[model samples]
Target: MASSSMLLSLFFTILLFFFLSPTLCANSQGNALHAMRSRLSDPNNIMQSWDPTLVNPCTWFHVTCDSNNNVLRLDLGNSNISGSLGPELGDLKHLQYLELYGNNLRGKIPDELGNLESLIGMDLYNNEFKGKIPESFGKLKSIRFLRLNDNKLTGSIPRELANLSNLKVIDVSNNDLCGTIPVDGPFANFHMESFKNNRLNGPELKGLVPYDFGC
Candidate 1:
């Protein structure tokens, strides 16, 4: 027998090059996320529910996947998406839930998204993004739900976010931020609506005022 049919055609050509080399490296990051969705400028077309020929990005439509298909989640909230945020989204290297809430995305927010080191969850809330908040997001230590609430970020709040020890819920509430908010670990069990109505001093709540709770 022709040497067992030449070792069964070299074991099906090494199992078709190990199953087409991880689907050609997950379609080369799904063709760079479909060429960054054609240089987004969605106006108000609201990404027409992002269709890019389905298939990868785990069959599109608010994409979410994992079973080796990669891309975990991308909610696209309040869909009136305006622009900015395309650092080819750090090549979605197994992205974990990125929801752009109340859309109208402006700029900044992208210090290459700290290269999504298996990001847990990031929601860019009530958008109109200004600047500051990107000290590479304290290098997302497998981040656990961080919401940049009511955007227009100013400065200060980055005490390297107290080194996000797998942070469990952080909301940089109502921006134009000032300072001094960094109290001991996890900001002493954050509340007071997570520092609502900024330029904060702290510790007051109950319908603030008295120089907005100048604690």
Candidate 2:
């Protein structure tokens, strides 16, 4: 009879863990947003509603979450924010739209952002970001719109971007990007205006020349 009582207690503990573990896991999404809030310098206080003590980040302004409370979008565009992005932003695995344009953000775009497999539109234009676009961005299979224009970025556009069949619009203009632009897949439809003001050697020549022709 004592052993039966112990078994009942153990069964209840297991049941309680299953019931509470989801809330704890969802709270981590809030934690990820709070981590991001702590990193950026929000001068306009646009993120004033991002209270970390909340059960989840669904209540935070500029942050969108799904029905299950998974983070979906972050609309922090033109908010006069400064500082660079960090890897913590990658924890929002369900994120789809990341709009961070027209800010004072600088430094290399974090490679961890490529881990956002659900990303659809990544609008990071009109910032002071520098360095090569992360090659890991090739992993963003769900991406549709990629606008990285008007930055200080250099180096040949990564050829891996050519694999995104779902890509519809890509604007790398007004930067220092060099080498041949990928003319394969959806890139074949993008006009020269999408690639102007860069050191690009023009489109790829298939078998005649290499993709990294200029730089």
Candidate 3:
């Protein structure tokens, strides 16, 4: 009888673990977002709902989640929040939209963001970001709209960006980018205005002209 009791106890423990696994994952994603809130300066109290004590971040304002309580979107655009993005943001594996435009945010875009494979739209325009665009961004296979215009970024555009076959609208204009713009893949269909206001020499002319000329 004692052996049967021990077996039942073990089964219950395993069942409990499986039942709590999703909640545990949600808590971890919440902690990642809370880490970001700790680094930012929120003057408008827009992040008041980001209570870490909650089981998940699904209840937080400006945050959206899927039916399974996985984070889906963060709509903090033009909220007057200012701070460099944290690498912890990469923990939102289900995130689709990340809108942080028109702020005073500075520093390099975190290369860790490349881990957001489910990302669809990433809008970081009209900010004060600098440094080279992360080559890791080429891993964003699901990304469609990528707008990083009107910043202070410099360096040659990463050639690896040409691999984003799903990319539809990409505007790197009004920055300090150099080198000839990529002319293959999605870049071939983009208009010159999308690459305007920068120091780009022009489009890549393939073998006739070097793509990195005068960069």
Candidate 4:
């Protein structure tokens, strides 16, 4: 009788854990957003709904959540919120769109953002960001548009980005990037204007002066 009771208890415990997992994940997503707000300077007070006391961020403004309360997008573009991006952003595993373009945000682009496997579009253009593009961005299998133009970024473009088969728009113009432009995969369909004004010498030459030509 005791053995049967113990097995029943274990089963209920496992079931309870599974039942509460979604809420727990939602709480984590909310925490991640709160952390992000804490790092940025929101002079407009537009993020008033980002109270950490909330159980989840589903009801928060500028944030969109799915039916299961998972974060899907961050619509903070052109909000003029300055300050560096936080690594906490990576915690939004279900995030799809990251729109923070045309801001005064400065500092290195967080490598942690590459962890957003569900990411479809990422726009960080016209910011003051610097440093090399994170090579881990190649892991975004669902990515379509990657606009990082008009920043202070330098170094060679990651060849791994060319591996994204779902890529539709790839604009790295008006930056300080170098190396020969990739001519393979989705990069082959991109416009030259996409790579214009960068230090990139030319398209990839199979057996010539190497891929990092001018860098």
Local distance difference test, per candidate? Answer: 0.75, 0.90, 0.92, 0.91
Task: Name the 10 consecutive residues with the lowest summed lDDT in model 2.
Answer: 206-215
Q: Each model's TM-score, in the order given?
A: 0.36, 0.92, 0.94, 0.95
Q: Per-residue CA lDDT of candidate 3, range 133-168, in tens?
A: 999999999999999999999988898899999999
Tens digits of per-residue lDDT, candidate 2, 52-135, equal 887888888998887778889999999999988888888888999999999989999999999999999999999999999999
Candidate 3, residue 135: lDDT: 94
Estimate the lDDT of model 2: 0.90
| Rank list by lDDT | 3, 4, 2, 1
User: Model 3: how far is 186 from its true place, Å?
Assistant: 0.8
Q: In TM-score terms, which candidate is top?
A: 4
Q: Report the Cα lDDT for residue 165, model 3.
A: 99
Which ranges of candidate 1 are over 4 A from the true structure? Answer: 10-12, 19-23, 26-28, 42-93, 96-117, 121-142, 151-166, 175-188, 193-215
Backbone clashes per model, in order?
Answer: 0, 0, 0, 0
Q: Regarding TM-score, does 1 or 3 come out ahead? A: 3
lDDT of 1 at 191: 74
In model 1, residue pairs whose N, Cα or C atoms come closer than 3 Å (at least 3 residues apart or on different chains), thus clashing, are none
Q: Is candidate 2 or candidate 4 better by TM-score?
A: 4
Where does candidate 3 clash, by residue pair? none
Model 2 bad stretches (over 4 Å): 1-14, 209-214
RMSD of 2: 1.8
